[model samples]
Target: MSPLPEVPAAAGVYPITVRWSDMDAYRHVNNVQYLRLFEEARVYAFKDWFGADRDLIDEGLLVVSQAIDYLVPMEFAYAPARVAIWCSGTGAASFDLGYAVAGPEGDDTVYARGRVTLVAYDLLEQRPRRLGEAEREVLGTVRGEPPALRGDRSAAGSRGHR
Candidate 1:
């Protein structure tokens, strides 16, 4: 398969362990497991981006939407998979994060591309909440272009991948 587009310079790269159970009978990582890998990366990224003292999960961030495009099948390996993530878009109450699952930095074999839209929420108030200035500022540091996934009509004039 052709190598995926280069990951943005501002993106955060997190190495995610691929569990043996993550593989399917097809001998490749299951499509659904990609989401888990993304989640693992986010957890590590948030801590580093927002600082360990700040707990965004406890403060409330909810996944409103998610999408992924499988570009190549990946088999389980001893080395952890590298997931590069960045802020793609931002709003008052929500933001979009782009993800690329691939091999180590020098390796260009991207297995998948994905995006997740998350909303700032108030668990105590049981309602969506606006993002704080501090949160927005943090997001700005990691801002980059969205993943050019298949079926993503929002990506320029080019038709999405089949």
Candidate 2:
């Protein structure tokens, strides 16, 4: 397999445990479980980025889209895998989070790369909401380029909207 690209410096590094249940019949981590891993990382990351005092989830941050590229099969292991996450893009009401699932720090084997688009929403109104200035400022601290997944197009030329 090709060597994975270097993770962005601004990314938050989170160690996520790989449960045996995450393995599939093929003896590798199930493709679907990658999403779960990403979710686990996000839980840890958001708390760090936005602070534990804020309840962003309760306030309504919704996942609008997600994409993952599996580069190498990840076998089950006792040690937790490291998931690096960072804000890749921001808009008026939504933001993109890029993820890289790899071996823990000092280990370069990246198993997958993924991105998720999340929109601020109003739970009471049941509609999308614009991101507040504080939210934007928090996201900016971790902003960085998206992961270089295979067949990725340049963001400026191809990415259409939030």
Candidate 3:
């Protein structure tokens, strides 16, 4: 297996616990539920980086693409996981957000890692738009890190910001 990528200590971390319904029939957390954890993390990151009042949906920004890599299965009642979000990179019309889902354990053992690229879009125009200044400023603060730039860009594309 390829070595897991290194994650920075300063990467924003949002604490989340497994919900009872998150487990599958086999008793392990379902693969799909992990994405929900990442979603919660992203919301927190948006509020922290941007303003809490950021309502991307109303602004017509929504997630268009996402990719996740599952490492090891998590138990139903495992300790709270820390989902970390790092600003991967920014294009003229889009930007990428990388995620590391680490157990309550140390950082090296990320249960999963992934990236989602968001685009700024004008719903009325039905086309991608440039990211706003405020949003860019929030992303700029988390740009200078290894995992952020080191991830895949072929996966990057424009979609809505939310």
Residue 160 displacement in candidate 3 (angstroms): 24
Which window of 10 residues has the lowest lDDT sum in candidate 1?
153-162
lDDT of 2 by residue, 71-114 (tens): 89999888888988999999999999999999755667989999
Q: Compared with the true structure, what per-residue lDDT tens digits does model 1 show for residues 89-140?
A: 9998999999999975566798999999999999999999999999999999
Question: Where does model 2 exceed 4 Å of error?
Answer: 1-5, 154-162
Q: What C-alpha lDDT, on a 0 to 100 scale, does residue 121 get in candidate 3?
A: 80
For candidate 2, the clash count comes to: 0
Clashing pairs in 2: none
**N/CA/C clash count, model 3:** 3
Of the two candidates 1 and 3, the one with more favorable lDDT, higher being better, is 1
Badly placed stretches (over 4 Å) of model 1 are 1-5, 154-162
Question: Which candidate has the highest lDDT of all?
Answer: 1
Q: Candidate 3, overall lDDT?
A: 0.72
Residue lDDT tens for model 3, 45-88: 77777776776645666577777777777775456777788788
lDDT against the true structure, per candidate, is 0.88, 0.87, 0.72
